[model samples]
Target: MISSEYCRLMARYSTWQNTSLVNAADGLTNSDRWKDRGAFFQSIAATLNHIYWADALMLERLKGNGRPEETIKHSLASPSNWDDFKVLRTQRNEEIEEWAARLVDADLNGTVVWYPGDGSTRMERPTALCAVELFNHESHHRGQVHAMLTAAGAEPEPTDLSLVP
Candidate 1:
């Protein structure tokens, strides 16, 4: 079982990382930020959008609800531009931090059931495992964005967990 303290700490880390990345990315032009760099999600903007969508879904599931399904491609195209994304991303980062802050030790226990992007079957998994995945998933994609940002000559903050503040 994971403690709520872990959730709170991860939430803090997420906020620190998100702000650093968005700030760094703000230096790039729209075309530059949206250019496909052959990363897994194709571009910095699209990867950020994908993370935004999936994080919302995971948050809902953590609350025992399912979000409307959308294709991976749809998520990639979501908001379709950078300005809208930046606004919504700020809101989401706050929501995620709030949710994590509200958790208690028992909140991470038991299983959470939710449909995937396909929305065909209801799969169940331990809440602790899902909590881990929730933070890990964003970190995974953010790493891709960080690489793309740097390759585009945009400098994001260092990603060391110990450096979170």
Candidate 2:
């Protein structure tokens, strides 16, 4: 079972890495950031949007909040506005940090029943494993974003977990 302390640490690392990547991405011109390089999302903006949507989706699931109507689209209906995206993403990081702080070892041992994707089906797993998957999902997408950014001629910081300080 994962301890609350471990969850908190994961949250801190996530926050740090996300902020770093965003900052690096910010250095590019809007056109450059939004350029299409033929990736899944096709553009940096779309890819980031995908990451944001995925993170938000997982957060809602982990918190027992209802899913957004749009699911994992390249654009968001709620955070559709660029300004709103920044605000919501920042808020999400804070929410994640808070959730981590509130977790307990017992909470990790408990099971979370969820649908991996759309439809009426359900699955169960240890809560901590789900939580770990939540963070891993973010990191996984961020790596994709980083690769896209680099390929677009914008250098992103190395993302080795061991590099986290």
lDDT of each: 0.86, 0.73
lDDT of 2 by residue, 19-92 (tens): 76677777777777677878887777777777777777677667764333345444455444455666777777
Residue 119 lDDT in candidate 1: 76
Weakest 10 consecutive residues of candidate 1 by summed lDDT: 67-76
Highest-lDDT candidate: 1
- lDDT for model 2 comes to 0.73
Q: Candidate 1 on 1-165: residue-level lDDT in tens?
A: 689999989988988898889999999998887798999989988888888988887887888885435423345448776788889899989999999989999889999987776678888999999888989999999999999999999999999999988
In model 1, the runs with Cα more than 4 Å from the true position are 67-77
Off by over 4 Å in 2: 66-75, 78-81, 115-119
Lowest lDDT 10-residue stretch of candidate 2: 65-74
TM-score of every candidate relative to the true structure: 0.91, 0.82
